[model samples]
Target: MNMNRTVLYKAALPIVMVLICAPYKVNAYNIEDAIKAVQLNNNGIKASKENVNIAKTERAQAYTTLLPSINLSNANTRTTYDVPQVLPNSSSGDRRSTSLEVYQALFEGGASLFRIDAAKHHLKAVQSDHQSQVQEIVFKAMEAYERLVVIKTVYDFHVKNEEAMQQHLNGVEARFKVGEATVTEVAQARASFEIAKANKNVSSGEITALEASYESITGEKAPQNMDPVDISGVYIPSSLDELMQICLKDNASIVALSSSIESARGNTRVAYSGLAPKVIGAINVNATNIKRNSPYKQDGTTYMIKVNMPLFNQGGIEYVKIKEAKHRERKQKAALESQKSAIISAAVGIWTKYSSSHSTIASMAEAVKASEIALKGTIEESKVGTKTITDVLEAETKHLDTKIKHTQAIQEQLLAVFQMHQIMGTNLSMFTNTRPIVQTAFNKS
Candidate 1:
């Protein structure tokens, strides 16, 4: 019993130690699950959310500026003079003073109101940017998912092709033993088998890398049997004009840049307001307490109206900012134009790719069928000595290549459809059957 216990402990110890040291395994994620996890956990999305919060607070602060301002202050001092101060007759054990001041802005040449507007616009821009970031992350997750699925499918075919080549090699060797096949034929078959093995090994390595990439993006391991998204039945725009119209309303980049332009215009108005004087209403109350001899007193409240004019601060102050704001507005407008151009270009490119992939897939499908039939016929002929061993092997390799190309065409078509959806700024919520993952931006009345 002691010996048996020792053996079991030895066997279990490594497993226990490994479990303790190994990295914690995350749960598997499907497409929708992966996007949700990213929204919750991705570091970039986290930072972008923080930016939205900052924008929200800044906008609130802008609104606060339109309200009254109040301040409270106090001061205390203890002094002991070797000789009693005579002129003012002030000899203090402790002198305490408190003041309350209020400054209400009656007017600021509309700069404050414009600043508030600018802050609000900036907030909107950042919110839109955050949404764009979410979409980008979703697109990346989808790409990773597709890559892993397609590559795995490719890997499976390579494995089967390798097996087929191995069988062919064995047949060729048997024929050579019977003097029915030449040594060169056997050598060729062996070489083809090795090449297929190398291809399978290479694809295996690709699968490992793709799996890691998928995990890194989704924050979890992918499931073994991933149901690939079939975008074929998804909506496709009828024409480029329809796509352009949708893009005009839905593209996040254009929306963000347009908001930025409005913000810049507001800031420009604010900068020009510096040329006018600011009217402020102010009041202050003073309360002071001296020693027991003096007691405490409350001074009368002082009320005053103050006007502050911007004198001069060279060219570095409001003047430069006004000019800079104008230039910035122009720059942003140019950027928006450029972005629209790029969006159109991308939409056209994807549409073309998807359109072509349809025919490419059909053609490749036919090629695969013909090659399969040719391989079978060639194999029969080779067994009957009417065809050389080399012809049969060549036909088999051609069939495998044709089938791989057909699969690749299918993958491209699917990805093109997904790409079209992404480029058109389709709501990310559409990716799931459940509730939407992203909020749709609404136009204000």
Candidate 2:
């Protein structure tokens, strides 16, 4: 029994060791995961959320202006001298009193209503600003993600180019020993190999910087493996006009500015309200002791109506305020137009880049293929003494350059598509499969 148990243990030991020593497989982190992390952990997004909350509180405060104000008061007093009798039996040095009052504004020349309207619009503007902040963060995350992918590709190509150059140099050196290759050929091959190494090092540095940026934005370390962003199915407008129209209507910046303009107009109306009268209605109930230490009491109810009209001020401040508000309204209107023009210009530039990247990518891809074939042919001809080492190295350099360009073009196109969606105020959730934080916050608020 002991011998049989030993044999089983020996067989199981290898399996156990293998399980413990093998590297665990990590899942590939994708663009969706990165964006989700940003939404959950980014400090800027949290701050923007607080701003939205503040705006909501302000709106609620404005609504309270329309509600009646109620007050309850109680007072006790003692005096050194005896009180003079005002009522038939009232002669008290000490007295106690209580009162309850309710007051409501009957009219305020629409100023209160205008202030409420302004608050509502201001809340909307804040919400839109929050959305803009979210979209900006999302775009930056996507850009960083794509940049890492492209740099990795380029780095890999550079490594391959280095290896190929090394091999070519070895071949040239061997031929020089046999007097079949000149010293210049070997020197050229060495230079090309060193250049490839330097290119690889530069790419490595860029990757490190980009990873740090990714962590800063997402509040997490970048994954060792990241899945490439796939933008093939992302929608693009059929025409520039369509894109411009969409941006003017839905872009967060544009929406925020439009709301601000409305808020400014409301403020102008409020300022103008200073020219009209204000009417207030109030009801009061009171009870008071008529005599010190006496059970006898006096009770009364009062109704009052007050109207206030501003005939003039020391400096005509009301008129000055109206003028100031009108100037502010005009400023907002000008800002709105400026924002529209900027958005249109930005949209056109992004569209132009998106449209051109397709052709660029196709052309670069073809160039890569041609340069690859040419390198192979040049290498073969060099071996047969029909091509110099310089020709072969040049072909290798062209091939590497083309491959790098092709990779960059692909990443640029992907980034542009995402930028387009961002500017259009469309939800990135359609692509990310996660609900947008902006929408979630709005719903909660």
Candidate 3:
């Protein structure tokens, strides 16, 4: 008897362990917390922020051209002289000198001035780029979050459907045993259960794939049973014209491109400044020992300013540099226009999706309801020998299809709202609480 009991215990242990662990496995992460965590931890976003900081440092350096460059020098030399033994004692002679020099560029044609402007503009562009990164990372998290939700919903639905298919197959098999259902009906019911089992497996696989994506963004295991997203603040503009205008004024990509153009123009001016005359001023202060044996010292100060003009370039290098900058400016201008066009197209596409998803969700909701009622009626009628097993299975399949479609529509609607925010360049606000220290986009300013 003890041996029999041990065998039973060993047979049941795996199932018991699975039961104990399953309930504790799911972790539900808050969406806001995930967004904040990604912002703080994501490596790419951190790198872009560093780029902004670098731009700020360059801006300060650009201002240094307006300041003088100072140099300090000190030199000490010692010489030892040995007298003959009959003569006096050996002596050491030392000489010390100190000098300070300052050189100030009173003028750099206008290169320094243009560089200062270029630095600020480039900083502005970098700031825009940083904001864009913040938006992108947040959107990735949101996308993964929403997709996980949809996958979980569908996965749960498939689980339930599979259970129902199993029950139906059991009932048909029992009826075949009682000689009430044909062998063909039993086979058909068993075939439907196998398909349902396959569907459940597919949904389970999708849930796992989505969880991996979710973890990659938020660095956490996906939380199950996420509450529906609350997009109460999302809205579409009344007309395409309004959206286009808003995008033109506020989109970060366009803002960055505009800043790049301004920076390129400043660079061109800096190159032009190289061809202009320059003025420089210098001052020198020197102190030196008058003699090695004497304790006297001499100190003198000199000051001078000079004007310099460039007569020619050896290989037209300066002119070519200006031309290169101008070409970059043109490219930036063209890119800005292209970005605007793309934004307009995206707005139209999202609007269409958002509008269509509204209809689809509603239509699918009704279809699911109708299919559920039909399924119930078909099952009842089949039990009375009126509806075939095939009819009942078809209705079950239709119901499941409608339910999955409805969930997909919901996912699309959610993503479309986010896409609208992305298009309008307001997505950063949705994820981050702290505003930028310096506003880059003119519209935001």
Global lDDT of each candidate: 0.82, 0.86, 0.82
What residue pairs are clashing in model 3?
27-223
Question: Highest lDDT, which number?
Answer: 2
Per TM-score, the best of the predicted structures is 2
Give the true-structure RMSD of model 2.
5.1
Question: What lDDT score is found at residue 143 in candidate 3?
Answer: 87
* Candidate 3 least-lDDT 10 residues: 432-441
- lDDT by residue (tens digit), candidate 3, 289-337: 8454667688999999999888777787888888998898899999988
Model 2 residue 228 lDDT?
84
* lDDT, residue 232, candidate 1: 38
lDDT (Cα, tens digit) per residue for candidate 2, span 67-177? 999999999887554435755454446668999999999999998899999999999999999999999987888788889888888888988988999998898899989
The whole-model C-alpha lDDT of candidate 3 against the native structure comes to 0.82
- Which of candidates 2 and 3 reaches a greater lDDT? 2
TM-score of each: 0.85, 0.88, 0.86
Write the residue-wise lDDT of candidate 1 on 1-445 in tens digits: 9999999999999999999999996644456776776667678888889999999999998889799889999998888755445545544477788999998998888988998999999998898888778778878888788777788888998899899999999998997899877889889999999999999999999988988887787677777876665553466778778777767778877788889899999989999988779999999998887774566655668999999888886754988889999999999899989999998998889889988998999999999999999999998898778998779878978998998899889888877766676766776646752343232232212
* Higher-TM-score candidate of 2 and 3: 2
> What's the ranking of the predictions by TM-score, best on top?
2, 3, 1
